[model samples]
Target: MIATPQSCQELLAHMVGFDTVVAYHSGVAEAERKLSDYLAGLATAWGFTVRELPIEGACGNLLIEHCIDPTLPWLMFDSHMDTVGVEGMTIDPFGGEIRDGRLYGRGACDTKGTGAAMLWALREYAAGSQKPRNIAVLFSVGEEHVQTGARAFVEQHLALLDWTPAGVVAGEPTQMQVLGATGGFVRWKMTTLGQACHSSKPDRGHNAIYDMARLVTALEDDYIGKIRATHPLVGNASAAITVINGGKQVNVVPAEATITFDRRLVPGEDGQRELNAVQALAAQVAASRPGMQVTHHQFESAPPMGTVDGGQFANQAVTALEGVGISSEVAGEPFTTNGNHFAAAGIPTIVVGPGDIAQAHTPDEWVSLEELDRGIAGYAAIMKS
Candidate 1:
């Protein structure tokens, strides 16, 4: 059965019904497990073999496989099962309501729509008389938060495949365009310590907030532009102090201050080296201030996806999209995705799918019904190409 816009929308509604938000971020356990099981069931019913890659303390990933020609190179499609929190949603986060030719839900655009399209494409191809290259669909978890599912897939399960992948298409909200490259991320915490005193006191104690103010000022004025590393596709690296906390009460002078530093790394830039540079600057700031202490702790780091290695696969994807009557082009984005992990693992990969990225994580998230139909056809074309 060929997939249609109405069928895609129905499947998307069912997918959106599952509250697959990452447990790490939402404090909800097995957030993706039910959806993984449900999707696995669908794949099994469609005659595709399914394997579960368990992610410790989380739902895990689903690998749905279908092979036709063993001698032919395999193609992989990856889409995350998890969505961000629905804290400020204006519509029903799980309703999957269709209004004005669009489907509304938390993951409607950012990517359950892609997931449904992939599933339908696989089903259609498997049921049809002709089979293209061997296919695998990986539904990964934790993409909205730490991306542990993708990392685990690359580190552990990727070697399990019998055939080398010709290319990997990572499903992101790319509006059917091919995202050839994307920026990376490194986040760490910086802390400043000082003596505590009453707010009314006249220079009785050092203010940690004041010290942190100087460090932030230095970062904004001196350090931000210093990230000279530039990638031809994703552009230059950048950094910002995203979160800060200092005082506990209005009348008390704070003794400690902490700020979270988030740095975006372009391809060819080292994440640890970026963190080290920030720490060095913090050390300099601390040395300049008398009786002040500054410390740092690194937390998250994700490598960037580069276009140079994935250019061929991206072009293939562009051709596939163009075949489906969509105007597609290879592009770059400042945001990171699971494609980074896949590309880092030496699999030529591109990020592409239906819907506008601007709709992702918005209060009224949506994906157009027409785009959903195109996504099914586009993914099916790539599967056969």
Candidate 2:
């Protein structure tokens, strides 16, 4: 068995040494296997039952359970194992180098920092005489891309688990603040069709690119501009045309053009409703231009997280941080997380961790050692509370 990690820094160092960068489209990788094996060994050494739920070929989510009593309410902690690609990283991506009181690596700030803190807290709790609350820790896979691991856990493992959780805390770069609300999003593509003809005789054929441009302008003015709904914490619902592609050679008139949209939703906004609205807008634009046709295809939709502010779970988290002499406030995040899945399943969820979201996917990502140390105590205190 691998030696037990004595501190958060040591655990983070060991974790960052593995290049768990998940490749797009292709999911299989050796780094995730090594890291999962190391984590499983540590959990087993600490008297926790470990189970690996396969998400794909060799990638899976690890569930570490320490159940003292089935009657007690269980609390779940979650963090992701996969990191984004390190193609343009400035420093060695897997070096785990510490400099100027910060640890630098790909997943260091995004989640490994939080994961180390969670493990350290669990270790400390298992070694102490105090009978902390029953807990389950999930190290999920594919969080950086599609969140297949989290979905699998909720759909497959949640029903199979023996205990029902009272609450869940998802690990993210929240700067140690409790996030009770977060935005959701939907991504889709729109295609505009036209007729192809000789460029010299432009009057004979319609240009798809020009039709797409008109559609974009109409969407910006009529659809996006008309949205007046807003949320207190997560701000307003918004939409953006993120990607556009079209055309062939300069001599040929393009027959088709496409654009992708990223639409952010607040708590009350329904993703399907929003998609229908966009489709209607596209139909309206197509109708305005004779002989033009537009089609929309949706790719993904994640619901916004809405937990009661200052409720039991949030208050408990705040009290835990305060017990450790760390001051924090409940806030909202503009981005979606794995917490959304749990919250959507009717479990009260909070997102809290040690780093800033700004540094999550940067070139030289880093997390403060001081914050990580505080996170260890904070998480332990939450369990104890």
Q: Which has the greatest TM-score?
A: 2
TM-score: model 2 vs. ground truth = 0.95
Number of the top-ranking candidate, with lDDT as the measure:
1
Q: 268-354 in candidate 2: lDDT tens per residue?
A: 888889988889889988998888999877588888988844467887899889988979887887789898888888889999988
lDDT per residue for candidate 1 within 1-385, as digits (tens), equals 3222347788899889889878877898778988888888777766889999876777778999898878877899999999999997999999999989999999999899999999889988888776768899999999988687889888877677676677889999888988899999999898899889999993998899999999999888778867688877788788888899998899888999999999999988888888888888888888998987988875998999886463888888888778878888888888999999988888899998989999999999999999999899999988877
Off by over 4 Å in 1: 1-6, 200-204, 308-310
Per-model TM against the reference: 0.94, 0.95
Clashes of each: 0, 0
Score candidate 1 by TM-score against the native: 0.94
What is the lDDT of every predicted structure here? 0.87, 0.85
Assess candidate 1 and give its lDDT. 0.87
Candidate 1 has which clashing residue pairs, if any?
none
